[model samples]
Target: MTESRCGYIAIVGRPNVGKSTLLNHILGQKISITSRKPQTTRHRVLGIKTRDQIQAIYVDTPGLHRGQKRAINRYMNRAATTSLRDVDVIAFVIEAGRWTEEDAWVLEQLKNYQCPVLLVINKVDKLEDKAELLPFIAARNSEHNYAQVVPVSALRADNLTALEQTLDAYLPEGPHFFDEEQITDRSMRFLTAEIVREKITRQLGDELPYAMTVEIEQYKLERGVTHISAAIYVERDGQKKILIGKGGSRLKSIGREARLDIEKLIDGKVMLNLWVKIKSGWSDDERALRSLGYDDE
Candidate 1:
C-alpha cells in the first residue's frame, strides 16, 4: 500500500500575480477570492486537496507587497510572510513576462528558507509569443537554485496538471493532516465574507479603496433560507456614498451579485443584506483591524 503523503505548499507572489487563482484552480473550487485590483487577498487561506493517498494543503496568501502605509497593509504583509513557516514547498509565483522590484523582493525573502522553491511563471496565456517563455524561465531560474521551474496560465487552467504533479512529488511522507473529503480549512462565514468582498472589489474596481472590508453581522438558518447581514465598512463618508451609490442602487447591485454567489457557495437560498458604514481610521488602527477579522494569528 502507498504511504500517505501530506504537506503545506505556500503560494507567494506580488499582487495580481494569480496566486489565489492558482490555488482555486488546483483545488477545483473558489476558496480564495480574486480581482484585477492588487492585494485583493487580505488573509491567508488554506485550500486542502486530497487525491488518493496524497493530500496537499495549499496556503494561499495575500500578495507580499512593499509600503505598509496603513495598519491593514502591514497586516496583509504579515499574513503573507508568516505563511512561509514550516512549509514543505514554496511556489514562488510571478508574471510571465514581467518581473518587478516587488517580485525581486519576494524572491529575496525566500532565500532564508531551506525548502525547495518552485518558480512558477503564471499568466503565460497573456504572452503573445510563447517562444519567449523559455528565455524568461531561464532568466528567472538562474536567479535562484529552484527545485523546478514550471510555466502555467492559472486563469485558463493551462499546464496546471503538471504543476500539481510536480507539487505532489515534493510532498513529504506523512499521515494526512485533514480529512480526505475536506477542501479548505477556512470556515463558511469567512468565505462568505470574502465572497462579498470579492464582488465589491470586482464591481468598484479602482473606485473602491483598500480601506473597505466586510463583516458578517448575522448568519443563521430561518425557514430553510440562510439569512446573512453583512456590513461594508469604509473609512470616510464620501467612500460610503460611493459604495451606496445613487438611491442605494450600487449597494443593491452589490448585494444582488453577492447573494447569488453566496447561494452557490452554500447550495441554499440566501437573504443577504449589505449596509455601508463609515468607521474613520479603522484601517490604520491595530485594534480595529483585529476586530474586523484581520487578525494575524
Candidate 2:
C-alpha cells in the first residue's frame, strides 16, 4: 500500500484574518507578505508543505472583498474564489473574537463545494480564559457543518500541530503535487514585487494598501551587486506625492528597507531603483489591471 498523503488545500477568508501569516508559519518561511491591513494579498500563492509521509499543497488565496470596480480588482477577487474548483479541502479562516454577517457570508460562499471544509478559528492567543472560547467555538459549529473545527493563533503558533494532525486524518492518500524540496510556486520576480508591496502596505496608511501594486521591471546580477528596478503603481497623483514624500525621504526609506530584505533574499548586495507611477485608478481600470498581470477578466 502506498502510505504517502498529499492534497491541495485552499485558504479562504475575509480581510485581516491572518491567512498569509498562517501560511508563513506552516511553511516556516515568508512565502506570503502580511500586514495589519485587509486585502494585502492581490493574487493566489501556492505554498508546498512536505514531510516524509505527508505533504500539504496549500493555496493562499486573497482575502474576499467587494469586487474591484476596475478589471484588476476583479482579478484579485477571482483569485480568491477560483481556487475552489479542484481542491481536496478548504480551510476557512475566521477571527474567533466575533461572528459577523461577513463570517456567515464566507461560509455561505462554500455551499457550492463538495470537498471537506475546516473552520479555523484564528487569534486564540487573544483569549486568556478557556471559558472565553466557548461561545466562539459554538458559534462556528452552529454556522457551518465543518469537517473539523481547529483553533489556532497564527501570530502565536497555537494549535497548529493539531491542525496538521487533523488535516492528515481527512486528506485522501495521493502523490505530492510538488517535489519534496519545493516550498513555493512564486517566481523571484513575483516575490520581489511582494516584498516591496509588503513594505508599501506598512508605510502607507488607509486605502493605499489596496490601491498599490509592485512590479519588477528589471533584475540584473552584477559583480557584488544585484541591480534591480521596480515600479510602484498607485491610483492617484496624491498617492504618488505622498509616497515620494518631502525631499523624497519616504520613498527612499521604503526602497532602503525593501532592498535590505531583497539582499537577504538573493544573498548579495542590492542596488535597487524605486519608481512611483499614477495609473489613474488602476485598481478599477481593466487595461491597467491587465498590464499589471491581474488582467484575467
Candidate 3:
C-alpha cells in the first residue's frame, strides 16, 4: 500500500490578491466568499482536498492589511497572521505584474518564518504582455528565495495542475487530518452568513459594505427545506437606511441573490429572511466585534 501524505497549506496575501479565488479553484468549489472589493473575507476558512495519496488542507485567511484603527481590522489582521503558525507550507499569493506597499508589508511578515514559502503569482490571465511575466517573476524572485514560484490565474484555472503538483512535493507525509469527503471545516450556518455578506458587498456601493455584516440569527430545517433568518448589522441608523434602500428594494435584492446561492450550497429549497439593524459602533468596539463573531481564536 502507498503511504499517504497530508499537511496544512496557508494561503496568505494582501487584500484582493485572489487568495479566496485560488482556494476555490484549487478545491474545485467555492468554500470562501469573494468579491471585487478588498476585505470580503473576514475569517479563517479551511478547505481540504484529497487526491489519491495526497491530501492538502488549505487555510484561506483574511488579507493582511496595515490598517488597525478599527477593532475589526485588528481582528482580521490577527486572524491572517495567526494562520501562519503550525502550517506545513505557505502559499504567498500575489498579483501578476503588480506590487504594492501592502504586498511588501506582507512579505516582511514572512521574513521570520521557517517554513518553505511558494510564491504564487496569481491573475496571470490578465497579463496581456506574456513576455513581461518572466522579468516580473525575476524581480519578485530577487526579493526572496521562494521554495518554488508558480504563476497561475485562479479565475481561469490556468496552470493550476502544475501548482498542485508543485505543492504536493512540499507537503509532508502523514495521514489525512480530515475525512476525504470533507470539503471545508466551516459550518453550513457560517457559509450561509458569508453568502449573505458577499451579496451585500457585491450589490452595495462604497462604505456600506464596510459598515455592515450579516449574522445568522436562525437556521433550521423543516421537512426538506432550510429556513434561515439573518440580520444585517450596521453601525448607525443612517447606514441601515442605506442598506434597506428606497422602499426596502436594495435589501430585498440582496436577500434574493443570497437565497439563490444558499439553496445551491445547502442543496435544497431555502426560505431566507433578512433585516437591517443598527449595531451602534460594532466595528470599533471589541466586545461588539466578539459578539458579532469576529473572534480571532
Candidate 4:
C-alpha cells in the first residue's frame, strides 16, 4: 500500500492578488469569502483538500498589506505572517503581469521562511498575449529561487491540475491530519459570519466595506431549519445609517442575499436576522478587535 502524504501549505500574497480565489479553486469549494474590493479577506481561513494518498491543508490568509493604522490591520498582518512559520510548503501567489511595492514587501518577509516556496502566478487568463507568460515567468524566477513556478488562472480554473501536482509533490510524507470528508476547520457560526460579511461587502458602497463586520449573535438549529441572528458592527452611527438605508431597504437587500447563500451552505432552510450596531472605533481598539473575533492567536 502507498503511504499517505499530508502537510500544511500557506498561501501568501499582497492584497487583491487572488489568493482567496486560488484557495477556493484548489479546494473546489468556497471556504473563503471573496469580493472585488481589496482586503476583502480579513482573517485566515483553512481549507483542506484530500485526494488519493495526499491531503493538502491550505491556509488562506488575509492579504498582507502595508497599512497598520488600524488594530485590525495589525491583526491581519500577524495572521498572514504567522501562517508562514510552520508550513511545509509556501505558495506565494501573485498576479501574472503585475508587481507592486506591497508584493515586494511580502517577498522580503518570505525570505525568513526556510520551507520550499512555490511561486504561483495567478490570473494568466487575463493576459492577452500568451507569449508574454514565458518572459514574465523568467523575470519572476530570477528574483527568487522558487522550488517550482506555476502559472494558473484561478478564476477560470485553468492549469490547476499542474499546480496541484506541483503542490502534491512538495508535500511531506505523513499520515493525513484531517479526514477525507472534512473540508474546513471553521465552524458554522464562523462561516455564517463570513457569508454575511461577503454580502455586506458586495451590497455596500466602496467606502463602507472596510468599516463593517458581521457578528453572529445567535445560531440555532431546530426542525430541519437553521436560525441565525447577527449584528453588523460599524464604527459610527452614520455608517450604521448608511447600512440600514432608507426605511431599512439596504439592510433588507443584504439579508436577502446572505440568506440564499447561507441556505446553500448549510443545505437547509435558514431564517436570518440582521442588525446594524455602532461599535465606535472597534477597528482601532485592541479590546474591540478581540470582541469582534480578530484575535491573532
Candidate 5:
C-alpha cells in the first residue's frame, strides 16, 4: 500500500498576480475571495486538496507588496511572510509577461529558503502574443533554480492539471493533517465576512476598497434559516456614505449578492443584514485591526 503523503505549499506572489484565484481553482472551490483590485486579499487563507493518498494543503497568502503605508499593510505582509515557515513546497506565482519591483521583493524573501520553489506563471491567457511566454519563462528561470516551471492561466483554469501534478510530486510523505472532506482552515463566519468584503471591493472604486473591512457581528442558525448581521467599517464618514450609496441602493446590492454567495456556501437559507459603520482610521490602528479578526497569523 502507498503511504499517505501530505504537505503545505505556500502560494506566494505580488499583488493581483492571481494567487487566490489559483488556489480557488486548484481546490475546486471559492474559499479565497478575489477582485480586480490590488490587496483584495488581506489574510493568509488555507485551501486543502486531497487526492488518493496525497494531500496538498495550500497556503494562499496576501500578496507581498512594497507599500507598507498602513498598519494593516504591515500585518498583511507579516501574514504572508510567516506562511513560508516549515512548508514542503513554495509555488511562486506571477503574471505571465509582467514583472515588477514588488515581484522582485517577493523573490528576494525566498532566497534563503531551503524548500523547493515551483514557479507558476499565471495569467498566460492574457498575453496578446503567446510567443512571448517562452522567452519570459526562460528569462525568469535564469534568476532562480526553480524545482519546476509551469505556465498557466489561473482564471481560465488552463494547464492546472500539470501544475497539480508538479505540486503532488513535491509533497513530503506523512499522514494527513485534516480530514478528507475539509477544504479550508477558516471558519464560516470568516468566509462570510470575506464574501461581503469581496462584494464591497468589486462595487467600489480604487481608494475606498482598501479603506474598509467587513465584520460578522452575529451568525446564528434558527429553525431552517441562518441569520447573519455584518458590519461594514470604514475609516471615515465619507467612505461610509460611499459604501452605503444613495438611498442605500449600493448597500442593498452588496447585501443581495453576498447573501446569495453565503447561502450557496452553507446550502441553506440566509437572512443577511448589512450596516455601514464609521470607525475613524481603523485601517491604520493596530488595536482596531486585532479586534476585527486581523490578529491571527
Candidate 6:
C-alpha cells in the first residue's frame, strides 16, 4: 500500500468568517461552536479530516483582528498568526459578503509566504450569482496572488468536495498524522467548556460572552445521568448579575440547554448545574489565559 499523504491545514480568517462552521462541517460533527458574533473563537482548535489515502489535520485559528488590551487577547492574536507558519497548505477563508481592511491585512501578509494557500470564499449563499464572484476574487488575488481560489459555502455544504480535492493535491505525502477515526484534538473538558461558551455567545448580548470563561468543576456519571457542575467566570459582579438573572431563571435556562447539548455530544444523559462567579479581570490576566489553554509563549 502507498503511504498516506498527511499535512496540517490552517484555516485563517477574520472574525465571524465561518471558520469554525467550516471545520465542523468538514468533520461531519460539531466539534466547534460557531456564532455570528465577532471573536466567537478564542483558541486554535484542530479538527481532523481523513480519507482512504489522506489525513488532513486542520487547525482553526481564532479570528484575526486588533485585540483587546489584555494578555489573553495578545495570546489569541499570536496563536492565530503563529499557525500561518509551518503548514503544508493554508486556507484563507473570507466571508465573501464583506471585505474589510482586516481581510486585506491577512491577504497582504500571506502574499509574502512561499507556501501554497487555497483562498476559501465562504458564505456563497449570500451572493447573488457566479458572475459576482469575479470582483471579490480579483480584488484579493490582485493583491496576494493566492495559489488557488476556491469558493465554498461552508454553511450550506457547497463545493466542499472541490475544496477537499485541492487540498488533496497540495498536501505532501507521509504517514497519517492522526488516527483515521479521530475528529478533533480537544479534550472532553475543553469541549464541555466550549459547549457552554457557545450557548452564552448565542444567548447573551454585548461583550458578556467574550468576557466570560467556563470551567467544568465536576463531572460524575451516576446511573443514567452524568452529573456535571460548571463555573462561569466573569470579571465583574454586574456581569454575573446579568448571567444569573432575577430568580436565577437565565442561569437555569442556560444550564438546561448546555446539559442537553452535552448529552448529545457525549451520547449520555446529563444533569448540569451551572454557576457564575466574578474572576476580576480574568481576560486580561496572563495566568488566567494560560490556565484556560491560551498560552502565548
Candidate 4 residues lying further than 4 Å off, grouped into runs, are none
Error of 6 at 73 (Å): 1.5
| Global Cα lDDT for candidate 2 | 0.84
| CA RMSD (A), model 5 | 0.9
Q: In order, how many clashes per candidate? A: 0, 1, 0, 0, 0, 0
Candidate 3 lDDT, tens digit per residue, 115-151? 9999999999899999989999999989999999999
Each prediction's RMSD to truth: 0.8, 1.8, 0.9, 0.9, 0.9, 1.6
Cα TM-score per model: 0.98, 0.94, 0.98, 0.98, 0.98, 0.95
lDDT of 1 by residue, 67-170 (tens): 89989899999998889988999999999999999999999989989899999999999999989988988888788889999999999999999999998999
Residue 145's C-alpha lDDT in candidate 1?
A: 82
Q: List the residue pairs that clash in candidate 4.
A: none
What does candidate 6's lDDT look like per residue over 1-297, in tens digits? 877799899999878889999988888899888887888888888899898998988989988786557777677788888887788888999977578888878777676667888889999898877688888888877777678999899989999988988988888988887888888888888898899988887889475857898888988889878788889989888899889989998888888888888889999988888889888877888887777666753
Clashing pairs in 3: none
lDDT of 1 at 223: 98
Q: Cα deviation of 82 in candidate 1 (Å)?
A: 0.9
Pairs of colliding residues, candidate 1: none
In the range 145-174, model 4's lDDT, one tens digit per residue, is 989999999999999999999888888899
Runs with alpha carbons beyond 4 Å of true place in candidate 5: none
lDDT of each: 0.92, 0.84, 0.92, 0.91, 0.92, 0.84
Question: Any idea how many clashes model 1 has?
Answer: 0
For model 1, the stretches where C-alpha displacement exceeds 4 angstroms are none
Candidate 4: 10-residue stretch with minimal lDDT: 202-211
The 10 consecutive residues of candidate 2 with the worst lDDT sum are 65-74
